[model samples]
Target: MAPNDFDNSIHDFDTTDDGSGPEPSPELWRHTPFTAFVAGEDTRAVYVRDHLPVLMPSFVVDFALRCTEFRSLPGHIARYAESQAWGSAEIEALRSWQRKLVRAGLFISRTELYTRAAAIRESNATPAKIGVIGFSTAGDRADLLLRALGSFAENVQTHGRAVDFLVADSAVDAGHRGRLRGLAGERAADLGVTLRYLGEQEKRLFATELIRRSQCRPEAVEFALFDPFGAGSAGGANRNALMLHEAGSVLAAVADDVLCELASTDSGDFKLALFSDTDPYDRWVFADRADALEAVSFEPRDYLAEQEKLLGRNLGDLLAGVPVNEVNVRKLGLTFLHLLDSGAARIRTTHLGHAGNPAIPTSSFYAPHKGTERELAAEAEIRYRASFASRGALARLATPSVGDGTVSPGMAIGLDHRELLPPFFPVLPAEDLVFGATMGACCPGALSGHLPLCLRHETNGDNAPLHPGEINRARQGSVFEFSQILRAIMAGHQPATQADTTARMQKLGRYICEFAAQPTLDFREALHRIVLTHESQKIMALEHALFTEIDAPEFWRRDIRDFLDHSRDRMQHEDFDIPYELKAGRTNEENRILMQKLIASYGRLLEDWPAIVAAAWDLRSEGKQFSASAKAD
Candidate 1:
């Protein structure tokens, strides 16, 4: 048999033989006594036997599970039965009983297998810090609540981490009653995380905490809160009514305070993730209160959306902030830190405690335009321009008119383009303006153009242009209009690939020669294309690899292939336009980096020095090829 064909039969179907009807084997169960079940022997039995336990309950569950078309195999049936610890003919009897229960609405409408699996999870789980409070109802609908409580109880026994139970509303019913109380009891007994059910009372507690913290520590706290409740009207309560009055303001303020307080705590900065059904809770409250809280509503049908959003938001915020000098960020793991720091942005804070100045304040220090929005706009514009100019800005006026606009004298600009800069730019404007202007003025010689404001002359050169706003605008337009010319001449990939690496490389080689044939290169355009091409390639490669199965191992390769094949019909474009796989192939530069690191870490692991030398040289050759190809294509 061929190497790839060795396991050809592994997934093949055999329909040649007649199938037998489903039935429980009684002999399998008779071997075990009832006493064995009570001692937790059942859990051990499945592992020891390495097969399905032949018993009543488990058999019933497996049979019901087998009702799904794909689970008709006898081995699957046996394993499913064993996982549930079922034995004997009684398994079938129990299965029948469960089916009847489902029909009667005593058990859930789903298959018995689902309930059993859930029950198993309940039995084995330890208390977790968070709970899922989904759409609620009474009676049979209480099953989810019970399952949640059971998970908490089971896990909390030996754990110290806090746990929270969830309560969410669903379309099938109203909210649960006394559910939070019940969950709270279970949590307390287990000494796990507290179970909180948000309501008026909870809101009050959160608000009070917020007010207390803010008044005491001032800027020490901050929050990013999303709508804590479901989205809709606030039930039409009179704004002046005691219950509704100040609710939005009070809640928002409290949320903000709590955020700051939690962040200030020695334990570590923490974020509160919340979902609400009311307008104030979801919008007005969090928006006005916790500037830091990044709250998103749970989708109409998704009970856990809030939970997912919370985890994502909190993790991202924590990771991106200043590294706690005293804390071990590595302990949280890079991925977790990345999630916290780079995920959905929560907010960015600087100056630890200056009662943060709004990035866009409505008022100004001067009169007239002082309070108008235009002042804020101008202030913001200055920063914006400063940033775009390489954060190197200083006041400068355009030279008045150049002989051919080659260099205008009216552009008497500050050393830095600082004056032209908008405040939005983060870098200091004054210093940059001077440095850039000076550099542009002199290359290798004495002075070229008159220094608008000479670095040494405290007052000379006053005739230079006083405004460069027009110059700035002209420069920007020149860039856009000549972008293509720039790409052809100036743009080139760095550390060019070697020739003869791949067909792709050969094409790029040709493209580069064609481009270079043109006369003079626009240095500015070249620089821009180099950046653009590299970025475009990076994005394309990442997306291509993520959507392909080219590098996935055997275990998941088949599934991935199937998914790709299935999705092919939906693709709007053809293969020629699709990006090639971005595999960390043996010859890839990124992979080479890893290899070098490995060699450094375990130098002794390389048994042949000559082989290593040859490989490195080969890689360098390949890189040259790649670079040449990039230029062509």
Candidate 2:
């Protein structure tokens, strides 16, 4: 209790000269514990005195994650991460490393980012190019496109001049073109927008024409068109981009199954809201209107009160009245161009959210980090049903985003000026992730809104599987429907600029090419090594985001064990055999060669991206000039 109660100097403490080394002082047992209890070693003597952290072994973090019981109330690993002064500093150090790394070269470094932003300002972009692309390949989806056009028509009818577009069709089929032309003539007045139709023959011609005009290599043009055996989606999406570019629109895109559901009610808005975990493509609501709202949000008190009422708080008075800020969200029908204008993100493209059914696999549940991993199909169905049914918008809006982390493209995201981006790979699963990664690296901004991604509806109901063992069937990960994070790892998602992304794609292309060049038995092993390193790095990025970017510790801690369990199981299983099996017509050897060629196209596209973009810009300029000259004449 007094100043003289204990000696102040190290000389007063007890120690032993064991000869091996000076023994720790007898007072060593009292070091701060980082957990509720210690099941393993909790203390260690200083080996490197220079470093300030005096925490226990590194596995303690894992121990915290795996802990079945929380002996200490109200403190999770995030809390433990904070309680240690050294840990806080260490985290800050990691955060600083990421901020520097992300800014310098994710896709483009912050320097290049600012440089491009400045150039845009200098050029004073000619009224942001925005268009809604509906590339219909199937003759049957005409009705769906018509429905979307109906929405567009209504917007124009409601707000004149706010909606205007011109569509061009160079139809190859005489009959189809004639019909389309007559239909356009009839509908143009009502729709308040231009309408175009490109049939199968026209699409093929356009593909060849685009290839020829761009001066692409013979192989690239061949690959883009024929794509023997139908091995890729690149041709179609590429066609969609070309269609939009030719028509002079570059913003939103839609598919056959997708609907552009603008509200007929007063609360109508393009509810491509932003959810922290996903992008803003959950539900479709769009109009031909452009007005700005405050960015980064400025919520009123009534917002919280309304949220509480909706969430069933104070149930006694359920019908409580509260003011709603309609203006804050009424601008939902905004184009992606407007979002970009208001500084949402400098993304090469944007992917909106979806609502029907999520785009993923049932196999995702095959290997989960949760304790209920082996739950029966009935149980899992309940959970899944509950998840899909939950519509807690109030809580979702209140939940803030993790700074700068990106969500991959939703099912129906907007794509603009496709040639400006590197080509998508032919054989790679989850290839869009690689494309998105490169795009994100180009700019380090992600718009935060209240929404979600993917909207595929369930093929089955809450009942049991129609067939025996179907629900609990052990499906392989090799299927095309699943997401292989490895694709992103290959594309160097964490850091790939236009130049850098091209180099990485080229490198991977070379690896694939080399793998197929010879009759080697180590195909799987070779691919394993390449993926292993980046997977580790991906995990590190996840940790960096969790510890530094987001504030919800309890909500995000579930991801810590994801990589850990992944490492444990993948080593025991040959999960790296990415193809899993041979293609129908080819043996392993032939398939490898086929894969190499397909992958090689991606590299070539990346290499020619700058040229492709320059050519596209020039064509757009020429078209604009031609219009101006014609007007003057």
Candidate 3:
């Protein structure tokens, strides 16, 4: 049946006053289970139900199995059947059985959900006020800081896992935070953007959220790691490799497989300097969890400016040392997909219905802010139309012989010549293959030395030109007109079917005469001639030699020589611009070269007359590349 035969339903809910009572609520459109076991809730179900079955019958196997006891379905019982009919009783019974099977497990199915729960768990493991890492650039340096902070969270002094999201939020002294904020603001200003740098309040909220979501607890540590450089600090503490690895790992753990990159940082040595502005130890205070350790002694600024420059360079060098792995990024995406759901399902479901269902409200007041029912339906129709149009275009370029016997394997459609062909030709595989052979013969090959062989490619100077195959099917048909005339002339001598033969002869004669009147070959005429020409000259020569040359060896040898020379001269003619006929393209020249080589094989007959002549009869029977060198006595 054609695609147009399907009973397609276009659900365009009438918003105007038709007053057919309240239409099915958009909630009913909530994707629901078609089968209890398989989540008929997914979008794949909609595709299978509405489209795939019509296009690809093979996909129906999964659906059939899901809905029926497909394995037990009866096969044809030829022995029991007196005639070809299966009978109405059997058909009815089958339909009833199929209906029962479909309804048996039609609803109340377990729903499949993406396993993104790990993401929530990871987010809760961090202890600090919220950690903010820039998605692209600041990511790497932010990663380093997180890892160093993770080590501290893991230490006995700081039961790292006790913190939420498995990350230790670094506690920066007020002076440092202020400096970082100032730097970030300045950079943001230079870039002409408003800066909302993380302050105490934002940090506290972020940390609280992380703690609330923690799934696991680990060992804690002493100090937190911070990417002061990433924060836009021109001269401050620098983050290094160890910090990045730890931070990256923790982030990955919390992200539940979301891919992340490290950000850049500045070079500076770690200093436990106590300043009157904001003493690091004095400013430190735990607002919610855990106690602080005893203060260690700090050194005063001795080589502040020098150390800052050296540290900046060292930090840059350290960051430059770590190369980002692209494979890691790719792996991260795959991991994320894996974490979503099992992707190896043979069959899947999709939702196509409107909003009402609580399970899948595809169209709610808030969801899919596209438009009204009519508009959406129009859009769907447009997509469907566009898909079919593109499919047709691809079919044209990819498979011109879609319905013809010549359909290639790459084409989805398969054609049987027995079912479709002109009534004039016999419905035989050999006959169809012969048609292909005839087409193939028109174009000459580089290896085959004949005008009617495969195509050949030839180079001129910088550019190469293709010599077209000799067999033009239209021309061959015209030549067949001439051949039919010859066939009639031969049939005249025979007594059987003389009148019928004569009429055919007359028809053929008229065709040939009409074609002959038009002195030049039309494109179609040229094509026909090439197709029918075959290896007629060679076969004729061999046949004539067997009959006449058996009586005169020397005479036969001389005739062969003359034939070879004449053919060679004709093929080698410099004025023969076969490229013009071929119409040059990338592969045209190659085909022309094939033709030249094939025609050039006749030169081999002259080189080794007896051998080539001997090989000629068996050559067509074998599938191989063959050539003749030169004529020899």
Candidate 4:
């Protein structure tokens, strides 16, 4: 259709506004009839999936035609239309026509419009002086830009010298309106061009012009259907459906790019780290890997799911099958460690750890020379080293604790497990290969109160256990201890002496065996008892150590007394209860009895305190060291 024919039809649709001009209302630009029509639709699904496929070509054609009409309109007519007042009936008629067009599957939503406009703007071919005008003041400048660009694509495509404009009807305040007009006039003068403010009627003319122009060319609609963002596109489903379908491919490509980049940068020493969260014990291991990847890799997901099958499930389904007893938990933990050992060999890095930490045999299964301890430690060391050695690389296995049992192939720094280990295993090692610990109700980080601090951290002032607070304290303490051990190790240290190391190993073995012996129902209470006994023993030893090993300072005495007093208060409060409920066969009465015995034990320990301190002082002159002394030639 000729441009004049389109303009004539657009003028016919301007019947809504009365010829008598009125002052522009602030709300005039804010009220978009098309927006209201879209909002009133019953379902966006049909419009986005089905209707959009049929409407995009018409939309583009209409938009292009409107730009053409606006370009061709005389300056006087355009100014006259801008001044015309839009009456309520006229607004309603306009809204109805827009709504009908949308319902008939011939209208495009603002989102689609903006997406295309933005793509156009980003293209190098876009003109430098393209003008974008918005009628409403309610939306931000971005929204205005989208609307203007979408409405005048043809002008942007055809003219390289057209500047954008925004004649906001919401500039109702006379002073603001005056300032806007003045700015427009100054800009026009500067550019040696004319800037006319279009009214609601004039905007309607533009819309009608687009419709008339589009109706003349039926084939253009079909062409638009084939455009990716057009209504006629074959797979014009929902907005994101196409993108989602290609997500896997996109991810694969991204992964390939990352691997290529890594290989390019550090050719020989590049680490191909793999981790899995499917095995409960390796949750922290996986987390540590994640932390490492976050630092260097642009795409961490590439490494995250690499070993999903080895763990028998994806990370999302790791905890789906819960273990009912300590045996099952231990089995899972061992399995996780073994899997980690295997995965580490596949990677390029020569360092391998059980759970993202240095390879330390923490389980009692590898404690000292007690039966299979040495054998198992040797087998484990050989197994890990051979994996890397087969690939022409040497693997270094290191541990934070000496009690983990040393093998020739690995280094056992001989640190005390209690001093070096956290209460719960952390995903990342607090110290080089020492995983920090955390306390939670779940298996991976749960603190079974095997440690004295872990038990006390869970207890309240009344001796009743705090639900999560104590657990949180244990977790925090674990991290703190890990940091301390890490710092100590970095400063250069040796393992504990053989005698001290044996004693610690024996203690850990006993605790583990006793814990494993408890029935599921009695596990919690048993753990509590063990923790209490251990704490009492520690206090007794500390009393003796004060005189013999540590200097007896005033602050030390006060600190010891204060700690004992707090423990005594907690034990005395009968109302204090365990934070969690006992298992199916356990009872509160059984727990209560245990608490009574503990309280009595605490009382006895305090009564013997004076004698204990005196005995410790007597032994001070003996000057015996508990830990083995440094070896001298």
Candidate 5:
């Protein structure tokens, strides 16, 4: 029968007669012995009821000899069966007995039976420590581990030997009141073994055991764990190494298993490779303490000061030391500076900080304030904007005085607004410049390189909801028109005439509106593309920025190039090098169609140069007039 066809209630299966009778009422079954066992009461009765029929005659005799009540029950059943001539004819009678056991919840499910049998065979072949780590509040996982262990221990084929298990919980608190502990302890005791809990001192204890087992020195083990910041024990790297040094192998979550394996290797020598996720090419390898310290000491103080001088602002706080909260911001600023110096046209930005905000104090960056939401946000904005201006970029603070402003020819449009924009458009302030520069350098076609400049918006203050009409108007008025001008300059063979530029802009606006109206447009897919592009771009941008800031750029460049090549090789060796697949449940054909549309749009942006320049000039003139009018008022 199908799973759905089965009766929902256990009471539907009769225990008496030929195992076929009227289904019992749910209320009646609720009070049965099996139900009582399931409710955590009188488990021994259910256990005995299930196993008694399955036990061999000699085992039953021995058990009966010990217990007075069941002394003659096994004998009586055997005699009765023999008198009736037990054979194929008595198969229905035997099935009825099994059905009764099932109704009592004594018979195991087929899956559980096979699993237990398999575990028993494995344990008999090779005895080893079976470690189970459960996260705090994950009682279900803990229960599953305990049940599997119990099944293996109770199986007769396994010689009734319990497996050694270490139950570790990752929760740092001293709350040991979980019911899994009690359940595991009881089960372990029944199976003649003890349940062990590994606490905060587990690492040290395991390490000590490992040293004893392997007869190795404490300093022989090294850990290669994920630690973005060199915070030592706080980041768990130091602690992991210490544990593995004392213990031959450490038990950790699947994510941390790779780190643990670094220590478990038979060979004592291993190199630690630390690389920035933002820049795949930027890497450091620490063979010893000296290499690590040397890598850390490469300062960008002078480089940052040069940028600060350009913007007429203090950016020492951003480059002084890494703030815990704004780790990525410094890299972002450096990337933007490098791109600007590399002859990229006006870098676009969204929500770049205003000039009014105070520079973050050196002390504040090192020791952050732990306070209410308002205080934290205030501090974060300060650091965020300081980091942006660290590279000498101007802030396009959105105010009512300037209404949806214009971009200069070969310059980025600065949309410094408080309203939230569509997910596809680059919304992050100065970070967009970094992404744009990287994208421009790495991607094919002139359009991919410059498309980023058209979408940048420099926002300030909190995000507020924007009306769909307002969003549509902003996209149509400035961004679409600006993109057309860029496309004409980059891809158009001939100089753009006034008429050609005007025609292209009009067509682009219509396309934007039509695309927005489409029901099939996936906002999530657009967001995913933005993220992927950012990641890929950031890698190149970060490497370029690092090379520009560091002393002996040529030597460092060679090293970084070699490191990236090696890293790529490693990824390939590990089967981690996979080609990008179209996401958001899109077919290959759909992806191709979308790409063609984007390419066509980019083509439209490449029109006549003169027309594009003229259009920008007109917009700037209009913006100046608006600004003058606002000032006059």
Candidate 6:
């Protein structure tokens, strides 16, 4: 049966006022599990029904187990299969959007784009654009931007290259933006890397102005400042990366990932031949000492008090001139990043790497492997799932039939081109994947070159979500992870030109209208399956990324296994009964009612995507500092 054919209850929620016929009455809706999950979601805590483990089914084995046993799941698990299918409902609409890209002849060379645009590649050691995509709650992650800028200055000192740093914040916080800009100016000026800040409104105004100046009927632009997919989101933090791509430009998103530049070359003046590396790191063993120590929370100011809590021995000795083994340094790094006083930075933007506690509550469908060491290993897998997929994706870009896999405005990627690549919508956490995939689809061989350049940095483990030894069950769909399955599956059906892409989008709109109205539960169930499939494919992709395991240090290999083993005991503390006090929020009925409203809203958004993408692309295009932004009109 098609994925949509699964008989699911979460898909049955009514969007109508009467709640008549097959749809439940509003009064009856109050008691459903779907509503309870979303209405009651937050970063802190929620009760997990015993059978529905918090672990994501990212592995094929886990996903298979869930599908095999899905029919026998408890009512809450089955009902909650789609507490928020609305998110997927919106994302699924992008499939219809892809067919619109005209399958004109493919060009696997970046030079073709420059030739077609009548543009020349600017030769320079410095990147063309570097925008920092900072999405947070009231700019709580201002520190990350600060840290990234500091690194940029350091990078200049280290690599001896000029930088242009841009911060395009999606969160709605003006005062916060002002404060960051204030702190950034003097620091940014010294390097001569002009720093520009744009909040959502400013970005829109800039995009609108660009559109007005162009005088092209707004629909002609292929990029968006935000909401490229026409789904109701800025796409994700990676949207800025897409907007920054123009012709033969090399751009980067100043994110938390460490910069370990590797050797690269170019395919003539037009194509950039560089590598985008996602070098995975254990939170405790970061490549950089400062980041490593910060992860385990080493407070030198209050060293005496914090040491007894974590290392028992004074890390003062380690920080001092005292000598130590690599093992001790790793241990200190863990404590340095861990501060018992600070639990899960509460900033809630997720910054695209912090999972386990995503900013939004997503699908709760899970397999039966609740508390196994294998499940604990899965946490590490999901934490960096995109890196694996992105590594594997190089294969798609490197296909002999396809052009060199060169991505534009690539972050977590290094691109050689410096021209226009369409900006992506921040709808799903996988916006970066979308940005890369979309660029690849538009010009499969346009990439200057394909090389694996993984950046090594601490990931979710640095977020300090759990106590020293605790790894809680996590939500699969959230801020940091990409729906690689979505991108991977859609890869083959790529449209050639933006005009063809629009045509396909129109066809999808018609299908969505009918699909939403159909009594069949395919759309909701199909989306749900995609979520699981993403997890499954994620684990499978690790094979491509982990070929370097043979070179890992003995200590990292031995103790890392022990740490994961130790975490299993801590995670096995399962609880099905959430106390009334602990579960204080909307009642089940209230949550159900709210869910229906969201489902209906998402359905509408999905249907309206084509119009939304066209307008938003024109506007969102302004969010990046693309020199060609004016010409894009």
How accurate locally is residue 630 in candidate 1, as Cα lDDT from 0 to 100?
A: 7
- Give TM per candidate: 0.18, 0.50, 0.16, 0.17, 0.18, 0.41
Q: Residue 462 of model 6: what lDDT?
A: 29
Sort the candidates on lDDT, descending order: 2, 6, 5, 4, 1, 3
lDDT of 4 by residue, 567-593 (tens): 444444432233222212335566444
List model 1 lDDT by residue over 1-633, tens digit each: 122322232243332211111221110000101111322423211111123332334334334433322221333335556766877774464534532322322211111211221222112212111222111112223344444444433443334323333232112122333443354446444544443333333324433443352332211111101112221111111011111111211100000000111111112221121111100010011111122122221112221221122221222222333222211211111111111111122211000110111111111111111111112233344432222222111221111000101121111111111011110100111211222222221111111111111110011111221111322222111111111222222123221222211222223334434444333334224434443454344345434644652443332233223333322321322221111121213333443233222212111111121222233234333441111000000
Question: What would the per-residue lDDT of candidate 6 be over residues 264-379, giving only the tens digit for each residue?
Answer: 11112211111222211111111233432232221112111111121111122112331111111100111112111121111000011111112122211111112112123434
lDDT of model 5 at residue 108? 28
Q: Alpha-carbon error at 419 in model 3, in Å?
A: 64
Best by lDDT: 2
Taking every candidate in turn, the Cα RMSD to the unseen true structure, in Å, is 32.5, 15.5, 36.9, 39.4, 35.5, 22.7
Question: lDDT of all predictions, in order shown?
Answer: 0.23, 0.34, 0.21, 0.24, 0.26, 0.31
C-alpha positional error of residue 611 in candidate 3 after TM-score superposition, expressed in Å? 93
Model 1 segments more than 4 A misplaced: 1-174, 183-200, 208-633
**How do the residues 1-633 of candidate 2 rate in per-residue lDDT, one tens digit apiece?**
112311222133332211111222211111112222343475432222123333334344343333222111112233444555446666554333322222222112112222232233212223234444443223223344445455445543554324333222322345544554455445655554555444434445544555666786656544533344445433244443343244434444444444443211112332112122123222221111010011112222221111112121111111123111111211121122222233334323444333333333332221221212122243344433333232111111221111112444423344434324444443323545555544443332323222222222222233321111222234322322212433533433323322443454444544434543444555445555655654565456546644663433332234334434453344445543444223244564565555545555554555454444454456655662111100000
Residues 488-596, candidate 3: write the lDDT tens digits.
Answer: 2222231222223223323333343343334333523442344334224433544465465343334324434444344334333432223222233325345334333
Residue 64, candidate 1: Cα error in Å is 58
Which residue runs of candidate 6 sit more than 4 Å off their true CA positions? 1-138, 157-163, 210-238, 241-249, 256-411, 415-420, 448-485, 488-520, 529-633
lDDT of 5 by residue, 254-373 (tens): 111101000011111211110111221111112222322232222212211111121211122112232222111111212222222222221111111211111111111111111111
